[model samples]
Target: MNTLTSSAHLVNVDIELEAAVLGVVLQTPGKAADLLRYIQKPTIFYHSLHQHIYEAIADLYAQGNDCDLMAVRQWLKSHGHDTTNLFNIISQNIFFDLAPKCLILFELAVKRYLGQYGERITRMASDPTTDALQLLERVDGDIDNIMGSIQSMKRPSVNDHLKVFLNGLDGKAKNNGPFTGLSTGIRTLDEQTNGLKPGCLYILAAGTGVGKTAIAGHIVKHQILEVGNAVGFCTLEMKGSEILSRFVAAETGYSNYELDRGKGIDPYKINDAVTRLSDKPLYIWDKPIELIQLEYQASEWKRRYGIKLLVIDYLQLVKHSMVKNRYERVSEISLTFKEMAQELDIAVLALAQLNRDHDKREGWKKRPKLSDLRESGQIEQDSDGVMMLFRPHKFGLNYADSSIIITPQTLEIHIPKWRNGMPTDEDYPLLAYYDAPTNRVGSVPFPDVPF
Candidate 1:
C-alpha cells in the first residue's frame, strides 16, 4: 500500500483493477496469450491471490486449456488458490478499458520495484564504504532496469504481418516513390535499400576521416525536416556541438572550415539553419556511452520524441560497462543493435569502422569487404545491410581505372552484404557527392547497375 511520488506516480495498486483485467483475460482465452506478452509476468498483480489467479490462467492457456470461468476455477482449486476469490474477479462487470487498466497495473508494479531499488541504494549509501560517484551511476542503471521493462515485444506469425506488408507496398506505390520504408532523402540509397526500414539494422562502414559522421548528419536532417520524422543520433566519437555544426553546414551549404574559422561566413544563413532546426524533432548525445546506457537513452527517446530512427555514430566505440574482450564486446554490441532495432520497432543506422585488413588487400580488394567490418563476424551476421565506403581519393588513390573520372570529392559506396535486396555489382559501387566543405554527403541516381 506504499505510495510512489516518482515521475510515473502510482498512488497505490487497486485490487479491483487486477480483478477487472483478469475478468477480461478469462472471458477470452486466445487474448490471454497476447495479454501475457504485454504484461509479461503475473507479478503485476498486487495481491498474492491475484497473482496466483493470473499464473493459473497463463498456465492453463499454455497447456491449450480454455481459460473459461469453470476451467480457471478448477485449475485454481487444483493449484490451491481459493475459488471464492475467483468469484469476486468473475463478478467484475468491466469488460472494456482493459489496456489502460493493465498499463496502470504495470505502472504500479514499476513503482513497487523502484521502492525496493531505492531501499537497496539507501542501505548502500548508509555504508561509508560505498563510493558516491559509483552509487550515482548505480542509480542511473537501476532506473534504466526498471523503465526498460515497460516495452514488451511479442513474436507474431508471418501471417500476422501479411496485411501490414501489403498495405505498406500499396502505400509506397501510391504515396512515396519506390521507398516502402523510411526514406533517406538520398534517392539512390532509398531506391536501393527501400529506405531505412523497420526491423533492419544498417551499418555504414568506412576508414577514419572517410565522412561517416558527415553522411549520418545528412541522413538525420533528411529524416527530421524533409521526411517529417523524428530521429535520435548518439555519437561516441564527436561532441553534440560538432554534430550540430555539421548539421548547420549541411543545412546552409557552408563548409566546416568556414563555420569553424568564421571566415567569409554569412551569419544569416547560419541563423536560418538554426531557426529551421530549432523546432525539428532531433535528439543528440555527444559523449561516449556504454551499450546499456545507449539503449536506456534510446528507449526514452523513442517514448518521448517518437523517433522513427536511431543512428549510432560508430559501432566499435560502443563500450561495455566494464572492459571486456574486444572481439566479444563488439560482437555483443552488433547483435544488441539489431535487437534494439527490432524491439523498438525503429530503424537503426549504426556507423562502423572498417578493419586494417582491407588496407592490406591489393587492387579493388583494398575497398572494404564484408570481412573488413571491425569484428565482422557478428556485424555481418546481425546487420540487415552493410555499406562499405571506399574513398580512393582519401588514400591519395583515384578511380583512374573506372570509365568516370574520380575527383577528391567522390565517394564510392559498396554495399557488399544485403538481406532485403542484393547489392549492386561489385565493380560498380554507388557513387555519391561528398562536399567536405559543406559537410554533406549527396547522392544522385546511380546508373551503374548490372543488367
Candidate 2:
C-alpha cells in the first residue's frame, strides 16, 4: 500500500468553495464576524493561502477594523504574506451571497481534517515501534478531538439557546411530573437538586470505606429500573462481574458478602434477579480505561442504547497521557468529563476520592469539603454539583444535635455546592442509611431516631 498515494486519493478539498467563503468575508465584514462563530480558526481552511487570508481577516475583525478586500490585503502584505494570488482569486470569484457557502466550506474542511487524521493513523499503524494499543488510544483521542471541534463549529448562539429553553418550559408546563431530568430515587435529594439534569456533571466524593460506590450504584439502579432510562457505567476499579453482583444485591436484597464468597447463595433469588436485570438497558465497561477510551465507549453506548446517564466509578483512577503531573492530568480529565456531559447531552455522575487530609482534621471538622476533592480543585469548579459523603460513625461521632443517636450505618450526604438549585441549612446534611450487607443506600426519614 503506497501511503502517500492513498492519502492524496482520500484528501478532498474544494478550492472554489474556499474562495467563495473568503470572498464573502472580504465583501461583508460584519457577516464575516458572525460566520467566524461557525468556523473560528483559519486552519479549518484546506488551502494555505486561504488560511492566511482568513487569519488576517480574523485579526482585523478582532481589532475592530474593517475586514474588506483592501484592509485584508494591506494586513496580509504588512505581515509579509503574499496576497497577490488571494486578491486575484477573490476579485475573479465575486460571491456576493456566501452565507450557505460558508457552512459548506466548513463541512468540507472538517471532512478534509478527518481524512488527514485517518492517513496519519494508517502511517502510524505501519510503524514497527508503535504499540498497537497506544496507536489505537491516540487515534481515539484524536477522533474525539476532531468530533468536538466539528460540534463547536455548529454551536448555537444565545438566541438559539433561548429558544431551546423556552421549548423545555413548554414541555414542562404540559407534563404533570415535576422533574425534567432523571431522578435519583431519593426524594429529598431529588427535590433539592431537581434530579440530575442533562448536560451537567455531578461529583460524589468521599473517603475510603464511605460507600461512594454504593450510592452511585443506587442511583444507577434507580435510573435503569425505576425511571426506565438507559445508563452506562464505566468502572475503573472493579470488574464487570463485581459491579453486577452489587446490582444483584441491590435488586434482591441479597447479602453481597454471601454472594461474593459463594456462600449460602439462593439459586432462585439469583435467577429472579438475573431475569429482572436482563431486560434493563444497562451497559458496563469495567476494564481500566483512559479518558479518551471512556469517552469513545460512552459515545458508542449512547448511540447504540441511547444511554442517558454515565457513571465513572472514581475520577482519580481515570488515566490520561496528555499531561505528566497527576494534578494537571486530573484537572484535564475533570474538564473533559464536563465537556463530554454537555456534548453528549447526558448527566455524567463521577465518583471522586476525598484527600486524606480530612482524616487529620479535628472531630466533626473531618467531614469532607469541596476543597478536599483529591488531586485537583478543578473537579469542584467544573462539576454542576458536588456531594460529599460523610459517615459520622466512621469518625466516632455517634450523636447529632445532642439528642438523636446516629446509627453506625448513617451516611451524611453533604452538598457544599449546588449550581442550579439552592439547598437550605436543613438540607445541607441529608441523611441516608447505608446497608452494607445489601450494598444499598437509601434516604432515612426526617427526625427519625436510628437508635
Candidate 3:
C-alpha cells in the first residue's frame, strides 16, 4: 500500500511531541507564529476542545466581537464549557506550568486528525464506484473553501485588495455592458439599460390593471424566443396556463378571449402561435405563494434549461415558508429576491402592486412614484430599477383615436434607482405595444407588435 510521508510523520511520536510543545505555546499567554497550524490537523480529543475554541473565535470574528482570549474563554464557558472536563483542562492551563504539555497534546491531536483526513481522501480517490458522490463532496468542499476565502477578505484592512477586486469586477461589468441578455421588448430600453444586467433585481410597480402581467409576459416571450435565452415566470395571482395562454395569444396575434372561443380568429393563427412560441425555451411556475418552491424550481430550471431571466408575476402574492409578520415578511421576500438574482445570475423582474393611496392620487394614470410600491418601501430600496405601467386610456384619455374615446395603454420606464448607471432625469411615457397573439408585448416599437 502506497502511504504518504506526512501521514507517517503525523502518527509518529516525534511529530506528536513537537505538536504538543506548540500546542502548549499556543494556549500560553505569549503568542507564537499565530499558533493556528494545529487547527488544521486536530485529533478527536483536541478536536472536541479546540473545536469549541475555534468556533467561538469564528463567532467572534463574524460578529465583530472582541477577539481577546478572555472573551473566547467566556463564550466557551457559556456554551456548556463549564460542564466539560476539557473545559477544566483549558481553564487550568491559562498559566505557564501546563502550557508546554498542552502544546504537546495539541500537536499529537493535530497529527492524528491529519492522518485520518489523509486516509479518507485516499479512500475516496481510489474507490472508483464512489467517484460520483466523492466528486460532489469535493465540489461542495471547494465551494465552502472559496466562500471561506471570500469571507476572510472582508476586513477593513483588506479594503484596498477588495477595492482592486471590485474594480476588476466593475471592469468586467463595463466590458459586458448590461444588455447581454436583457429584454425590455423595446430596442430603446435595451439600448439604454444594456439588457437588464444579471444580478439585478428589477421591480415593476403600477396601479391595478396597468397591464403589469401583460408587459412581463411580453418580456419573457421576447427574451426566450428572440434573445434565445431560457426564462422562468412565477405567477402567483394568475394560473400558469392562463399566463402561457396569453403568451400563446400574443405570439399568435390572437386575443385570449378569441383563442378561448376558437371563433373570430382564424384556426391557422392558433397553429402559428403554437409554432412561434412552443419551440422557444421558457419555463413557468404559478404555484400558490411558494417562494421556497420558486427558488427550488429555479434551481431545477437552471440545471435543466439554463434559464437566463426570471420574472415573478407580482410581489404581494409571493408567500414564504413561515411569515410571522406580514410587513417583516415582505422585507424578507424583497431580500430573498435580491439574493436569488445574485445567486442565479439571472435577471429578476418582480412585478409589484402600487399602494391604494397611489390609486387615489391625482396623476396616477401617467406615472407611479417610488413611494407607491405597496407593503414595503424596501422593494424600492432593494430594486435595481423601478418601472411603472400607466395607461392614460384606462382613466379617460385618447392617445390613439383623437375623435373617439380611446384608452391607449401607456408604460413608463422610470429610473428611480440605477445602482450602476445614470437614472433618467424625469419619467416619460414610452410607447407600449401589446401583441394580441403569442401573448408577447413590448415598447418603443422598432419591431411592431403584430396586432
- Judged by TM-score, which candidate is best? 2
lDDT (Cα, tens digit) per residue for candidate 1, span 202-269: 99999888888877887888888888899999988888888888888877877788888988988887
Q: Please, what is the whole-model Cα lDDT of each candidate in the order they appear?
A: 0.77, 0.78, 0.62
| Tens-digit lDDT string for candidate 3 (83-122) | 2433233333233344344445544554655577678778
lDDT of 2 at 432: 81
Clashing pairs in 2: none
Model 1 RMSD in Å is 16.8
Count of backbone clashes, every candidate in sequence: 1, 0, 31
For candidate 1, the per-residue lDDT at 365 reads 70
Q: Is candidate 2 or candidate 3 better by lDDT?
A: 2
What shift in Å separates residue 70 of candidate 3 from its native position after superposition?
42
Q: Pick the candidate with the highest lDDT.
A: 2
Q: Estimated TM-score per prediction? A: 0.66, 0.67, 0.60
Over 4 Å off, model 2: 1-153, 424-428, 446-451
